[model samples]
Each structure stands twice: as C-alpha cells, then as structure tokens.
Target: MSTDGRSAAGERAHDATGIAVEEGIRSLLLLMPRVVGRAKKMHIPEELQSFSLAPRHLSLLANLVFEGPMTVNDLAARLEVAPTTVSLMVGDLSRQGVLERRTDAADRRRTIVGIAAAHEKSVNDWLGGSARAWRAVLGPLTPEQRRLFVDTFHAYERELG
Candidate 1:
C-alpha cells in the first residue's frame, strides 16, 4: 500500500497507461481556469456590449440561433431550466430588443421566441467564435468519439452538481 492508502499495484496499472487519475486531475485543474478565461474573453459585438449579458443568456441564445424559433416551453426543455425562468429571460431580452416574441399561428395562446432581426447578426457573431472553435476541435473526431467527449463533460458537470 502507498502512503496515500492506494494500492501500489493499482497505481502501477495507471502509470503503465501514462495517465494516472491524479495526473489527469492536476492537468484539468490547471486547464479549466484557462479555458474559462479564454471563453470569457471572446469578443461581444459592440451592439450587445450595453446589454450586459450573462452566461445563462448564452445557452438560451445559442438554442434560438441554431435551432430557429421555438416556444418558451421548448426552450425550457432544451435549457433544462424551468419554464418560468425561460419566460423571465425571454421577457428581459424582448424588452431589450434582443429577442422577438410572436403569437404562434398554430396555437393562438402560445408564443414563439426568436432573436430579433435587428440583433440576429450580432447574436450570431457573438456565438460563432465558440461554435467555430468547437467545430474545429470536434470535427476530426469520429461521431462516437465526439459523443464520448460530450458525455464525459456532462458527467463532470453532474459531479459538480
């Protein structure tokens, strides 16, 4: 047994792979902050700088940008947030002229939300950098490999929760 109470045999098995859990953890600890910092530094378009958007808005906007218009309930499902929370975000963005809410022709009572035409280009520009980066990083990976990478990130998030 090692001083840390881990078995020497177990440690040796990891060492043989040249990637022990401790080493991976240490690398991630160093890398995560840099990754987040770089993401934070991604340029916000001049048109959007005044809105003071937060991280929560990014996911919501990305969904609309990529998937086109959808109702608040649909957005809530995609975001894994409450409908009320989505409503509040939609309302705020709508008031700021960042989003447009329209009465669904199919359902008179339902409202479909989308990026306003005036702000669409700015929103796309803001999100395009991250999307391009992800595409460049993941494009070479096989579909299965991409799935595994995303699953691993989701597992990490669940652990933090």
Candidate 2:
C-alpha cells in the first residue's frame, strides 16, 4: 500500500532499526528546518548587521571560528564552493574589517583568513546565541545520549561523503 508497494512496510518493518528509522526520519523531518532557521537567526552578530553580511557570510565566519583559519582553497573545499566564491566572501568580510587575510609564513602564496580579533566580542555574542539555542534544544538529553546523537550525525555525514 506504500509508494514502493510493500504493503505499507519496508523490508525492515519487523526490525528494531525499521522502527527507529521511521521515528528518526519523522523526528528529523520535523526538526531539521527549525534547527537551521534557529542557526540562521542565531549566527549573525548585531554589530556586523550594519555591514550587510548575508547568511552565507555568517556561515563562513562561524566556520572560521569553529574550524580555525584556512587558505581560500581549503575553505572553498570545506564549504563545497569554488575558490573564487570563497575569495569573494573573504574579500567582502576583509573589506568590512571582519576578517584578516595574511600570507602564510611558510607558504608565501597561500593566504590564510580568520575572524579579526577586534570583532571577537561581537562574533562571540553571535556564537553565544547559537550555542544557547543548541543547549536549550539538546540539554535535556543525558550526556551519553547527547554523545550518541552527535556520533550518529557524524556517521550520517561521513556516509554522505
């Protein structure tokens, strides 16, 4: 009776994983958008709002803060974007005094970009909101359950790659 024509149950219908899969997908379907929307709203510092940094720009900043600085090529790879696209974002943030780009001491041709120290307070404030939101959402879980949740998501991501 299902779309795949399996009497409304998949092959794992009788299995533990099947029940978990059904519940998990249902939970994710309900939570994914709300989580992303919370992150999108939480990731931007108030001070940077005057500079017209978009969600993409804020994501870049968040990535830098959490993952550390990187060269344009490395950042592009991580973001799954072309180097030029990353270059444009870096240039924009750099010009706005939100980021600093400098030559790598060992590699003259590589330019590393990071969040400027001058704006750390504002950036931290933005990150704080995101952290608070995640805590509010996930804090109810036991530590072991939280770890399992994190590990599950990491496994999911690896499977994607």
Candidate 3:
C-alpha cells in the first residue's frame, strides 16, 4: 500500500503518466532548435536589415504593429522579459524610425509605442510571408486536423503559465 490513498500499482500508473508527459515535452524541446532555424531562413525586408534587431525585438515589433500601441512596461510583461530590455528595444526602434514614442494623453508620464509609417509596409509584408509559409506547412492537413493542431499548441502554451 502507498500513502495518498494509492496502492503500489496505482503509484506505478501515476508515475507512468508523469513519464509519458515528460517524454512528450522532451520531444517538443528537441524540435525547438529546428523550428527556430527554419524561421530564420525566411526573407527579411531591406529596411529591417539596417536595424538588425534580434528575434525578441522582431517579436516585439510584430506585437506593436499588429496589436496597436503599448507602453514599455506592458510590452515587457507581454514578452515576459525585463522592463529594461523593452526600454532598450524601444529606444533602438525609435532611433531607427521603426517605432514612434508618444506621451499618452491619459497619462503624461507614460510613453506609448506605435509602429512608424515607414515600417508598416515591411511589417505587413513579413506577416503575409509568415502566413503563406504556415499555410504551406498546414495545407495538407484537413481543416479539422488543422484546427485541432492549433488548439493543442495554444493549450501547451497556456500550460507554460
């Protein structure tokens, strides 16, 4: 007999559940590097080449471009990075004219970030390219399968929390 109202065989079953879960997680971890490599091969716009932002900054820009303006602290929280990192990214983007910072009308002390007009075209182009690439990858799947796969991915990301 085992504690926690489980028999010895029950404990083995519980342990197997954990091992199987861990195995699935490890498999995803193994694929992570390859996914990143494939993503890096995608074309980037000439405008972005001069800025040379890292993957994190690119992700930040994507959020601002698509989701509308956000403050440095809000962006930092969303990206799960340090506030200083966001501040630095925003400063660099501001200088590169990829981002514009303005004082929030509601709050004078807060600075909100928005994608600059010059960079919007590039941002939209990148999003379109990414969508095409994803469609290519998922095109073979049935619509139901694609929906299930996307839902599973979101569940996994939520589990990270």
The C-alpha TM-scores of every prediction are: 0.88, 0.68, 0.62
Clashes of each: 0, 0, 0
For model 2, the local distance difference test gives 0.79
Looking at model 1, residue 60 earns an lDDT score of 96
Q: Return whichever of 1 and 3 wins on lDDT.
A: 1
Predicted candidate 1 versus true structure: per-residue lDDT over 68-90, tens digit per residue: 99999999999999999999999
How would you order the candidates by TM-score, starting with the best?
1, 2, 3
Candidate 3 segments whose C-alpha is farther than 4 A from its true place: 1-34, 128-161
Q: Relative to the true structure, how large is the alpha-carbon lDDT of every model?
A: 0.90, 0.79, 0.81
Lowest summed lDDT window (length 10), candidate 2: 1-10
User: Which one wins on TM-score?
Assistant: 1
Identify the candidate with maximal lDDT: 1
TM-score, cand. 3: 0.62
**Model 2 lDDT at residue 57:** 83
